[model samples]
Target: MAGTGGVRPSHSPTLPSQLGATFPARPAAAEIVRDLPWDDTPLGPRERWDPVVTATVDLVLSSPMPMAFSFGDSFVLIYNDAYADLIGTLHPAAMGRPAAEAFGESWLSPGLGGVIEEVYRSGRPFLEPETQLTVVRADGARPEQAFFTRGHSIVSDRRGRAAGVLTVAAETTQVTRRLQNLGELTSRLAVALTVDDVARVVLGYALTSFDVDHCVFAVDDGNMFRSVRRIRGEMLDEADERLPPVWKRLPDNPQAPLVAAARSGRASFVADGEPLREVASDRHERRIRALAVLPLRTASLSGALSIGYRTEHNWLPAEQALLNAAAQQVAQAAERARRFEAQHGTAQLLQRSMLPEHLPELERFRIAARYDVGVDGNAAGGDFYDAFRLADGRLAMVLGDVAGHDVRAAAVMGQVRAALRALALTDADPPGVLAGLDRLVGSLGAESRNEEIFVTVVYGVLDPHDGTITLASAGHPPPVLRRAGQGGEAPTAELVKIPPGAPLGLGGRWQTGVVRLEPGDSILLFSDGVVERRGRALNDGLDALVAVAAGAPSGDPRNLCAIATAAVPGPTDDDVAVLAVERAVALSRSDTMLVAAEPTGPSRVRQWMGTRLREWSVPEQVIGSAILCTSELTTNALLHAGTPAQVHIDLNAERLLVSVADTGTRGSVIRAHTDAMSSRGRGLSLIEELSDSWGTDPSVRGSTVWFELLIRSTSDSPAS
Candidate 1:
């Protein structure tokens, strides 16, 4: 088997026994290596003797790295004990087999089989960079990881022909995982912002990156460690049940290492039996075998971050470090959220204080008012109501709802309410008051039209003297009037329909309407909300109100107002304002004086007049008419050129008077029914009918027309 380079053929039967004995003999090696290239002559101990060949075989077999042997032109390879372990019981007797034949389909991966074949064909060393491969175990149930041999090569023959290939390799799973973890850590840290966000990220990363059963971060909020972030195999059911009651009772208990460590700005690690001792009575200890409590510290405060394990296991230093960083980041974020809530609370308080304290009193009127600013979790709303007396002894009242529900709206409400009071006191008409309010609102630089701010108002002036209420409505519901009477057996209620006017700032013609208030009458003024509820028509609400008012007990105006307000269901989403005015009862007629006078006449006539006055219930403070009429007639007959004369007197309920007359030369004095002049003829006539009533006797004087006047006194009337 020797080649042309003077190399003897080792595979031949004529080959020297000494050279054959130098190599460890595989059952087929003697025949297989017979065509080798190297000389087998004994060189010294350093050069290759039988001992050297034996040592080389020992070295390859005993090396810690996985080693394998491949014969010429074969896909299978024979592996030693170390290589067999890497293959995990796959082909336990894998010796003298081609690598592909040994692992079957697994060895068919690209580049692996090709490289091995090239090595055997060329009889040259071929280096395969660190390549990964999957090798099936003997059970064929799972695959084990292995790294392919780097730089596999073969021993060549004298003519550079293919012979056998050798490979060396090791596993690199642990190192690869470490690099991946580092990458994940960097990514998580980059996006962590707030405390909750950091806790969420850390817990999420631990669950996904480490493939743990569950990850939870219990944040110590001074008193208790609240489970803020939790990632688990199953959605957490009754997670709190997993926590020890003692931990909850003493959230900041100094004796508790987790809490103490966090509050003191220190990290505490508990594992296995140690955690059970501190939280022995805790029910959660049974489920959580290993626990690490890390203190999250910012400059001002410190809190605890806890990690739990369902199984007993030791936590690695890397895991602890990652958790500690995450906890610290979460602490800072918690502090920020707390500060924001505090500032917001302060703003809300200030806004609330700006609202009105109480409603004012108005004589002979009932007023109910409410201010609701519709601001939730924020500042106060901008709605207000006011009732006050004007300088003219009149009541001035106003209810206004601003456009917004924020602090800005509240401020604007205050300004608008104040302006309304000032303008109202100045006796400005309703439209004038609104115009002034608009001007003032417009002047508030920041609260100008750009803010789209406006207010709806109902302003009124009530004169108690005549029970007259002059009101100017600006985009407000017309005040309802419930006259004190029954619509049949039920009390009647009517929405006092009036001319509509534009709301403030809409800029239009505004007119005020006057309503005379009779005794026992009521006037209702309110914001739209009191009569308007969603899902219910406004008319329906009005009807309900009317029904309630009709059923309510009668009392003062205030009582009626209360009943009306209670009729509406809560909550009156917007502000509500009601003003009621009732006139006082009138004075009795007897309390007034009456004046009466009858013309002087005969005693008989005087007697008749007295009888009439007495029957009419007239007071005794007048001069009798009969005597006066008689004296006048006698004087006219004696003092002037006269013939016969006549006298008459009359009296009645409201007035009394008398008249005397004289006759002319004609047959009888003709009484004129429609003439302004006739001296002697009219003197008696003027006194006749103009007085109560008068007549003439035709004995000496002509006929005469006379009257009596009765005067009735004037006085105040009571409430009807």
Candidate 2:
């Protein structure tokens, strides 16, 4: 047969006669097979070879396609010139070795040896589109095992009985692995949430799928670059002292390969003997023969991806393109992480601002509050709580939750909370205040009308005189009341039995309930975040909270609040707010003063009120308002009632109460007095604005005009 175009093995004169003229002249693989020492193989010496085997070798050497013929039961391997290239550097040494000795267990794979056995048994040919094969490289490189698609056929003697197997195969490892790796890389990057996550994915795929010994991924921060190094599949600590200086130097360095790649926005290769100490550990640089640096650049983010090879290798266009595609994916993931970080930071700030700074302290009441943010990007939760004195001398406490944990929800919560506070001040009715809040939320604009804009609230008014709490629900969790047992009995905790109305902004009627809390009894109001879990039922969460709260000291509101919040189940993916109030027997009065019925009663009450307020260190603004309200009420008693006024002033732990009595009718009604110049009816209007609450009550002697001013914490900012 005529020889193919490539170099041919040299023909020796000692070659068998059958093959002497038939074999291609000077074929490279033929020389390797003919020169192989057959004494060491099952086939014995070349001269003692069977014609069947010798003919097969001649046929294989004449073929252009890579061919390997395994003859007899020992399956000795004799491959052609084309097959030597497929085996890499294992050629000459593997020429006449047994299949087991040359290819080892790799040749015995089900797809290869099983098919070869089938061909021999049937005396027929077996065709496989692709069969995997692994071969060691003569240079001993790690990526020696390659994959191939092959066909097997029986080689027969002149008698036509099958005696050996012939394989024709083509290597397809690089292209196949590239495709598989690309698919896996895409899938992993799709779910990556952080830059570190992207690095792990890229490094892991490269170590197992590409021709590299180590890899690194870095992110640029405008000022410098931060990086992570992974050798094979294991991650190296960033603080490891043995790492190369290049790993720590910023990517902006002019001489660094990674920086060069970033500057050029392309792939850069460091050839053999080039300085790679900048990019690898000292121990790594000793074995690193070449390096490939790829830049990962996006509009919002920039970084570098570098791979190191232990053996000198010229970068191929196909491999370079594959790496570039991977870099693009990593850049996209890094950009996403950056955006998430910015949004999360904004959420944190907004969430912190909406929470209360301190709780209001009262004479006979103990109050505690807490707010816990979720662990998600929308950390600014809609939960809120506030305790303040209303215009009717009652303590108002409210707990509410907006449906989401984002900026919009937070904004709505602020608006809704302010509206509730204002409404509670003017109207003492619990249900009426909730109804007004519902209307206010609906009026917040189109966005507030979204179904997701729902809000649940529990608003209550506590009367210190009788220890009665009037609560209204707007589709919120009911408040739990804990009653301390008398005579050393165990205390009991249970949810207040109240009608759960529709959530605010949903246009439904709200309902109110009143519960009398005895001395040492407490009430806990909370948002759903403190009780809700992913798989738990609403009732189950409520039960757990009740159990936790019941175990706490009945008189310690702060401890009970902490216990309830700490008992929330599972991950807190939403904001939580808890407000607890405990009622004591009576608030101790620090001082009291009375003015005898006389024409100078109003003047006398002013001096006493001013002195007591200043002594208590009340805010100057609050003291001025209290003094004015007391003077107006006392003057009305001595002038309109036509009788001497009896003025009384009392100060307690929570508030200062002032009362003026005169011999008169109870028909003095409060008028709007909208005109700025009107002076006659403005006294009551001034009292309405300055004091939290004021009203006229009939006494045995005459009518008493009483008002209360709240004593707030020094830390609390005055409400607008």
Candidate 3:
């Protein structure tokens, strides 16, 4: 063949001898080239060929490499037999056509014609090996998009001038796609946070990218192997029950490929077996042909991950290594999740113990409480609430918050609550109780914590008989008292007139505030957690809480607490505690009984209590505690105070309050009586321990000694 110059080239004769010897006799592609109808194409006749064009053609035709000669400005395509198979269906018709017309649209791709143009203009050879370029090819029978690695160079004329570009290429689509998929799988595993997250990423990617039929991640649960996740193609399914629950200790069964892998802690391949097939659903058993399992090993445990194929697959070292890397990633992530779960459970247990086991009850009153820890905090927070009955037939509610969200702060809060409860029992005044709490916090906190701890609290004593609440605040939010309304009118929540004192741990005297209420009234006591947020003003949160309380059902104490806590708009950086009390009814004469205060007063009180409790169907444990506390109070008044004493027993659905009034000015005090022999000092000590609360009130005429017991339902009582 010759270029279309209408003259025989100088090297034309020598090229034809070489072409004739290689064609028809040596190469099938040369025969296809010789028989091509050049006159009908753009290159014209063989006699008109340029020496450089004909010489380049001879070289390309005789070469065994996959090479092509694209001649002239149009890049006329002329390729050898190796190159013919490389282009697949584009071959026979592509022999003498332009480069763009031969490869169709892909010839103009940046990786192809663009490189050729650069080689033609620069007159320099361009070489790129293993570089991917998408092209058309036939995989078995149908044409498909494929990848190739190609090298291009300038074809020089006899006169040493560039004429065209010659390219040598090789197909690499399968190898390239596999490497790319592996790279993506590794990237996805890097970002996985938990065991399930890693399993989802690796299993889903392997099924689709590696053309696998099934993937399973099984974790070791000591006694048995538990499948964390299993995927069949694109669908997620439960593990097959027929598979071995426990990995085999020995590889005695050659039929069990997954068991063998687990026993050996190495990757195993099975071309055909009932073990792998039996693990598949009945519908997919016939479709599965091969399986591969990789052992997952961590410092604490061992497991196996399996990948199944629909068609028989030859084992490759690279694929095995890829699966092993994935297994390691999953092992680390699973360990992380397990440790986090354990720590979370421990913190939850500690917080639960710090809260009240059960709220104390008062007659004609309902008590509800809630506590929420900060979402972002890792340790238990220092927010707590407690409710118990006082000596004067009143309910005492305490809500407190210690600064900081750590174990130390929680410990301080526990100490403060215990000390305050002890002080409140001996003293009748809320402000006096808080003042003693400040001194106790200063003394007890110094040894436990190096850093200064601050605590805020709202303590209220609610008299259900009179519907009056006396509140004391220690750098805490004022309690809201909601008055009941009539005629479909909603209740209104108002901040009580309490004087805010310095927070506990700082020495300052505090004052008490009083708020009078009616039956059906509700009082909400909360920590700053209910009203404090990051970007908002404190007053806004307080106002929002009031609104939520006002609109909430005053009759339901629990519902009121929920609404008030939820009123905070955003994340609460501190713990929140909401304690609410609703006055349901007023106490009447029927609720009270009197007994003459004498040496026999204690026994008489017990007899009356047992009878009343049996009639009301109160729990046996509550009745026992009530009778014991009443006896202690009556005995103390008879011994400590001079004669002319009287006993008043008050009963309500919530609690039992017993008061022993005497005409003596002698004040009852809590004195330590650890001695085994001393009897006199143990009276008030026993009253403080047995009763929920106890106190003494003095006047010009006499002083009254009182004690209270919390009522319990039958279900809340312990076995007698």
Candidate 4:
């Protein structure tokens, strides 16, 4: 024990404990204490160390617990390997430094160094159950939260005087963070108004808390159970990448772990894979070797959270308690979401029941309608549309919007729509229909003092025989007209100007406007939502709708309706409703085909066009030019747009017009000044040279390239 109590030379770096004197059972601990040069600090050399210091260092390093000792007035520090892990990056370098110096900014903030100093000065033991600390991991640059339950005890000198402090710490960072997140889970679940929302909040919390491979939240769905799951570091499908994880439904067999847990109303923990084989419902579940299924059971709802791992794991008591608490919150949220969905569904069903489920299908009158809900899908929207045949052999179409987004609004809309239909069946005209609807809304508004019922509507009557439509507007956006070109004129879409009447709630005189519907012409009636943006003027949206509808492939009612409804580019803050009706073009004189985006598509178009033209008795001279121009346009669409092209041709009494449309990112066709014979850029040049009047119109999805050819007369010249 020569180097044990006296100072040793620098060359002889080994301490007495290295030769099995003090730390005989732990050579690693002795080496850690022996490596540091004690002669440099206030604590002096190892050989000159006091007996109390020797005993204390032996106790600090040998213990399995995270223990550390700060000696004398300077509080020189020495700690064990367990303590090294607790401090993260503060280890090794902090071995023999003073506690205050080594602890840095955290010394005064966490009050650990001050507490230790007090313990050494007063020779009294102090214990703190919970204390917060910030740690920067050795492998990471970001600082993370940590907590500890530390106890400081006094270490006395041989003279019975207060000499140093001995500290023992238990890091509670994991459990503390999990508990904090659990609290956050409750707050987040409170706002979860739907089942998907609940699943999103619960699944995300479970995944982070357990450090498991995956987690799923399953809700009872009668004979089936719907589960929304998330896996660590997994790439989800684009369609499934949204708020509230997408759910997959499975059989509600009692043998399944999640199902069993929900039915048993208790928490189930599986320690091995063999027990899970029968319980797992799919390959994903079968991979889980260990599992914890916590049932979320309440008076109103029943569900289970399945937390799993690929490797076997033991669930701790603290973890079980936290998971159980989380399950309770999930159950409450599930109940709330179900209630909201139920009420929302009832309102939606009520409104849809009032509207015509199927439109009147007639050869001459082609109608299409679309109704879109607002951004908040939790509530039923007030927008509605209907197409029906009147007793007088006329097509009646109506598009209306009530001024709210709740059950009350939907109820008001249903009453107004139903009354209008009833009045129409009594042979009322467009003005009479509006007059009845306006009075009905006025009465409903007076009946309900809770909300002021306001509505806008455009109702129209189409006479298929005469090809005329009479429309009436009640504080609604005017109907747009898509007119098919006559002679050599190009097709165009413009708003049908009509005198506006006051909205339904405020009484005003209603009048009708007559629109002469030519063959292949479309009439579009839409709600204010289609033209009223959040910040922009109503005229801007109206202009955009006309442009979009005109550029649609043809005067097809379905295409026109879809194009007009999606004219606005942002989220729909209010409900959107649109209805379109187009007069049929002669089937024998018109043709439409979808050309695939492939190399052989142009050849297919050429062959098909030649056959159709010959069958229609078109002149050979015109047929040849039409085929070549159409083939060129189809080829351009395949090359530039990289999408399938919609090819449409209409032969009227005065002209033959052909159009090719595609949906690609780029839009609008600019005039190209290239050689007409060049192979690469000759598509447009060929179209301009051969056709009477050729142009391109850009649409929301892509562009339409069209050309008009003047025909001599309506004749039955040739039959191929």
How does each model score on lDDT? 0.51, 0.68, 0.65, 0.72
Query: Model 3 lDDT vs. the true structure?
Result: 0.65
Stretches of candidate 1 above 4 Å error?
1-249, 344-436, 446-720
Of candidate 2, the 10-residue stretch with the lowest lDDT total is: 1-10
Q: In model 3, where is the ten-residue run with the lowest total lDDT?
A: 11-20
TM-score of 3: 0.54
Model 2 CA deviation exceeding 4 Å by range:
1-47, 50-69, 72-163, 167-182, 203-214, 229-251, 278-289, 309-321, 343-353, 356-397, 403-408, 421-436, 442-453, 460-471, 479-502, 505-720
Error of 3 at 541 (Å): 5.1
Work out the TM-score per prediction.
Answer: 0.36, 0.50, 0.54, 0.65
Q: Give the alpha carbon lDDT tens digit for every residue of 74-101 in model 4.
A: 7788888666545654456677887667
Can you rank all candidates by lDDT, best first?
4, 2, 3, 1
RMSD of each candidate?
39.0, 23.4, 21.4, 14.4
Q: What's the ranking of the predictions by TM-score, best on top? A: 4, 3, 2, 1
Q: What would the TM-score be for candidate 1 when compared with the true structure?
A: 0.36
lDDT of 3 by residue, 377-468 (tens): 34788888888776766677799988888787788888888887787778858888888888877876687664377888888887766777
lDDT of 3 at 164: 78
> What does candidate 2's lDDT look like per residue over 92-133, in tens digits?
666676665665665554444445556667776665554343
Tell me the tens digit of each residue's lDDT in model 1 across 348-416: 455435544444544444444333323233355665667777787787767667766566777877788
Error of 1 at 697 (Å): 98
Best lDDT among the predictions, by candidate number: 4
